[model samples]
Target chain A: MNVAPNNQIPNSQGLVKGMHEQEVEIAPGTLFDAEEMVINMGPQHPSTHGVLRVILKLDGETVRDLDCDIGYLHRGVEKIAEHDTYAMITPYWDRLDYVAAVSNDLCYVGGVEKLLGVEVPRRAEYLRVILTELQRIASHLLWLGTHAIDIGAVTVLLYAFREREEILKIFEDFIGARLTAHAFRIGGLWWDAYPEFDKRVRDFLKILPGRIDEYETLLNANRIWLSRTVGIGILPADEAINLSLTGPVLRGSGVNYDLRKAQPYSAYPEFDFEIPLGENGDTYDRYLVRMAEIRQSIRIIEQALDGLPEGPVMAKVPKVIKPPVGEVYFSIEAPKGEIGVYLVSDGTTKPYRMRIRPPAFINLQSLRRLSIGHLVADVVALIGTIDIVLGEVDR
Target chain B: MSDEEKVTPPDPSGDQPQQSETSGEKSPQSAKTEASADKPAPPRAAPSDKPSPPKAAPAKKPSITSEIAGDPFIDKIKETFGLAITEAVQTLGQQILRVNRDRYLELCGFLHDNETARFDMCTDLTASHWPERSGQEFEVVLLLYSTPNNRRIRIKAPLADGEACPSVSGIWAGANWMERETFDMFGIKFDGHPDLRRILLPEDWPGHPLRKEYPIEYRDNEWTDKHIEYREVDYDTSLIDVKYGERK
Candidate 1:
């Protein structure tokens, strides 16, 4: 067994050595270092979902170790949360996970409301359910499109975007903005839904089920799709729970835990649906779970639209919002996973401290375990399965 | 463990002895909140391993002061590990326990393993700074949840400036990055974290930006000329120097 010298060790000629292909003739006659090759795979990559940079140590085509180098997109959002008043932080929540602004807004304002002991109207709660379910579908659509593209399924991207555009239109019709729509207040909604909000959302629900079926027909049983995702990233049931992963990733590992279902908040109890769980906990299982959740999201939205209540959306409150001194932890089931707002108010308009328990940021920690023994190419699929948004990951 | 562990006991001299006796102590503000009578409670996870509660009603009634009288976890921990719990009280429909930083891990393990208080998830761990509080200025708050009972607990341990906050990663692997992030932002050291380094900020960044003494203005950014060249970008360095003199 002839092992090449370590990179730190010098050959007879005193030329520096590093891990490289054996054919490379760096010096007169020095073999390449025996160390595993390390590849930095983002900060500017299409498959990375956002600006997430992963430094992967590889042995041939297999990934030996994975170290995620996030914070490239860190805007110090938590630090910013300390400075802004409770009302001002609404817009900032939209920036954490840009795809699911409604969910983010609900978690933050919901926590603040809990601290202040404000009661949201039943009608307002129903409206929140309707909007957030649609947001979940939209967020999952973006994830599916990019995830499929990562696995070499380009056609799914076009099909996913088709449905996603209509959801965005519904969002714009009422919320007045598309991507980072800062559309929530602490006590309740800033304004009632636009008249067209119901009709547009209903129209979207009518067509979304068929669109999802079309997506399933294209890739559900396809040989190539199965080969790429079926058993690629296998995080067992126990490891999944131990890692504190929430949402689809944890559910895919056979955990029947969803915050919306387990702890009903904001009219979630009014809707009827199933909590989808997968047994294998592989990439394919995660895909199946998210696909099932899209159908469930549609189910929730339809119920909310039909049973829409009539009342004031915004609650009566004082001009200056001041919550008593205490801390509250509010967790909601966002599309990707559980997004929690840990708020500590110091009896002032501005929050003393606010911490967001971002699902993507924590979920990314399990990537090292999932990627260790897999191929270099499979790292992309693992990342896709985790469904991380770098804005949340590096926040 | 230090011999001078000032684990504040449930002071008999304090105003806590009897819930019935405190009916007269209810303030005017609490009376107003009580008028709603049906203050909507925050959701609680239902028992029976069911994902969602079958019942349509919220978990607890809006007025949460009643349940604080018979709080089980706080009572149990006080009886079991008397000195470990520095302070325990009910707040906002949950138990807030201030545990000794030296015994934080042991207490966390007991909570994780104990039958009734099986807090399965270490949801969040971070620190907050209060410069005005002289002796115990920094407080590390850890939130835990028990999936079985559907209960949540907040453990806060206060420390002086340079004291070490013991790592809980051995008990919950997920606490790794959280502890690192806390250390990164607040400059609180975790005694035994495997890889204790900055998670969200650059490793060589100067001061803990979350500390009160650290200036919040943009002009105070400490990046040097070499870094600007290394991360080549065409931008006005003067913009960073403009103090936030105007309304923020």
Candidate 2:
């Protein structure tokens, strides 16, 4: 919103002189116009969640023009990927979609695997499914926490984070890191899960359903929550499809498209779960869809744990993978939506070209259209409903 | 289990029949040598030679060209718009079409609103910087997906240095952000994009960071000793100006 002053700005003395002399003439055919007030919503605002700045042109409370300014947190990830070797780039992938770091890792590794023509072991595939599903739940927990707080539901944030901490503990047990887990290797996982991993995951599965119920109990039937969300930011199914919206945001709009179901990867095909859809695409529907997805993710993790295969964790590829001179595009269903890794390898340790298909970046597009007629207060609600992580958005 | 307890087990399903005909015992070093060879001979280490002869015919020949010739979409596109399909690369599920930049917008309009190729979604709009190519410095890649047909097409628009590509924002509103992002990354200006500005970088930032030639870091010449000198500023009056005024 920091508008550079025009080079043709009139001098203050000229402005005062003009005001003093303006009374002399009154023209019948003079044109009058009013400039729209531009307001900036932070490169550091709490509602932005990260370094996202939006410049808004407002007529009172209605948003006339909105410009989203990102890259305040840009670390030149693509440039870094070019410099680093294929094996060394997994950590960078973790940073792209920090919330669902495991999913990001999976997408990158999966793409690299396809390029190298490496087949991952059954155990590795199952482990990946378990970890990714857990990561999805954790990510949704954070979304539920922050999103509820953004909508003025203060207590729900605490409840959501409490459950998220347990998931983080499990992640720590497996990967030895909580937030930026560089757990996935090029062909498979960094190492096999610890002895307690299966048991700990099972314990989480046992308690997660009850914990989800507690979260629902706190907010689902609340009159204020319903009133604030229902019928707000309604995106029709056709419009949602046209806008290229995905994940819960698209499903909430009554589109029954899920990459996991449509194009199953890893052990997603083996898992028995339902793809929850909404009749109406609204802020409320999005919330419901995400909440339902959390339970479905738990079901997948439990099933994966029960039938966890015993085998090697990594594929028998060369230490340094050099894919043929070809381009491969692979997409995975991340917590937010479809996170794709488009890799163009020219038979080298380093990727010739690497492009990230970030779901948040795509979902962020609908904001301007969604916010057109809605009040300023509803803007926060709409953004929360979208559930974007700026790490992925700015990347 | 502890490291001592965890034994590295040998490969499982050792007795089971190999699902693929490709040799399983070949070392990684040999594969590298075969890859580096100028003419990569069709892999000959398979356990049996009878099943491979039929595969060699398709492998040695141009498969993609043949596939494109039979594709109904390519023929329909040619029939509808009279635009020749100059180049086609089919790898995995993605199809890349090299088209004329001059007729790019017209083709996009035909693709999006057209009933046959109802590419309702402009999933992604990105550009690749080819610094070595003087005539064609940037190749704008547009990923279009049709939900009705379950088909995807990637359109490539090669632009010369300092040239602008036609913006598809008018066709699909979703392209607004994607095009802006493409502009921010590759510096390929979109001719008719509304409010075209740097989306991922600061306005005053030097150069497009994604361009292959742009250096990652540069010396901060603006940081002078005089600018770093401490000054006695009123804290109480500065709070409002620093917080609310700057935000406004």
Candidate 3:
């Protein structure tokens, strides 16, 4: 609601600026012409999810141009990674995409394991798959709730949070932290499945489908929700690929590429699940795609838990962890997109360069393409649709 | 040198099944212990006949070759763009190609348009600063993924301290911000980046923090003082001065 920059404009102000500004190449006798106005949307607005400041050049209500001004939350995470040891960096990875900390942890640890060529235990891989899938579901639920509230459906937010709280409870019981849980170690997990881990996940899975059904019942056919999102912010398949958009946003554009399906890692090859595709590439389609992904996540967790392997959870990693001089790129399908870690080791305990290929950071690039012609109100919905976390974007 | 020596001697050769995991741990440990030795460790005692040394010691560079004959993809790329690829190396199942900085754009265009390798997504673009390496102080790394082929390759271009590297943002739209981030962190210039301003740091911030020589805990007190307004506290008179605030 707070507009930080100057919003007031006079007719003479445009003429004063036109003298110094570059001449526009306009077709002769063009019927459509409008003066452009620039305004700042947010570095503080709640609907932006976090400090995502978008400079919007507006031609009336329609967005003429959009530029995102990020780095409000930059903590130099990559710089921090250089100083921290491989094992010490796991907790920092959790802070990259705080919403899907488990998935981020998986990517970093898996990258380190791949660099070391250490074979993780079967039990640990299965447990990792279970926890990350749960994280995907939790992340999608938070997105759905916040996205719905951004549009106007207050009821769905309540229902979504109710279910999300349950997942957080399970995470608390297992990993001792709900949000930024450093759920993984360098070689494998720090701990095996707790006594109630199986039962807790099974119970959640049993009720998740019904809860998903309730969400659909609330929003699928509702006129208000459909009107706000149905045909708004369309990104074509080819354009999405060119922009390197991933996760549900890319899937919503009908691109049939998911890292789990494309490049299977951990115990993902063992369990079977489908990557739901959206045809229209609209905000509504993206919404449907993410909702379907939650259901698929439940299916994956059920499979992983049902066939849980029994072995040593932690692999025999050296106390003084050091990797070879070569560099390795390891990626996994995070809830947001393809979260990858490109680690360069100079045969030392600390990484020479630790570059986290943040999915939200890349996926957020499509915001300009998606929100160009949309109205000011729809920009909020588009930002929500992208599902960006400023922590990862600014890191 | 000595680090490799210490890690190699501890490899349990008798244990075959767990050797892969244990050898991985020991070889790196041994390498660290024998790091000060004269000669580099010879591939870590060959516990399971691993291909390369356990770790890349500072003394020994990873062996690289320009001739990679077997793989059809590398062969085709080499055939199309002769001499552009300076060296090719396969380390731990990851294919890395070092390309000529002058011909970098053309190679990227070919890779994106080529039917066999339709690398639709420019997965990531970043740079690392190696101050110890003379002349080529920064290496810009690109991780490209061919969605159809489901293959990933790394293209690295080495540059002198302040030299400009050609940008790939023209090929992949996602590379725009990535190039900006790389420039912001490593002070490496991208020749044709659309908008190459600092993306992760303040516009007025000084020095690239990701450079190897930059300290881990650097504080920009100058910028903070310029932008942030604080109540002027006189240590001579203020009760909260360090002299009075010190605990006995």
Top candidate on TM-score is: 3
**DockQ of candidate 3, scored on C-alphas against the true complex (2 decimals):** 0.30
lDDT of 1 at A190: 76
lDDT of 2: 0.76
Write one digit per residue (lDDT tens) for candidate 3, span B1-248: 43343345335333333446556677566665554554435555545434233342322443322345599889888887789888888877788888888888888988898888888888999998877779988989998988788898889998999999998887888788899899999899999766677888877787888887675553446677789787454343332222211211
Residue A237 C-alpha lDDT in model 1:
68
Clashing pairs in model 2? none
TM-score of each: 0.83, 0.80, 0.84
lDDT of 1 by residue, A1-395 (tens): 11111111112111112334334545444443454666678878888988887777777778876677778888888777776778888888898899999999999989988888899998889888988988999999999999999989999999999998998888887788999876678778877988778887887788888889999999998898899999888877666766778899999999888999788788998789999999999999999999999999889888988999898998876678878777778899999888998887777787788889999988988888788889988999999999999888888
After superposition on all CA atoms, how large is the RMSD of candidate 2? Answer: 11.7
Error of 3 at B247 (Å): 32
Q: Provide the lowest-lDDT 10-residue window in model 3 chain A.
A: A1-10
Report the Cα lDDT for residue B145, model 1.
Answer: 73
CAPRI-style quality class for the chain A–B interface of candidate 1: incorrect
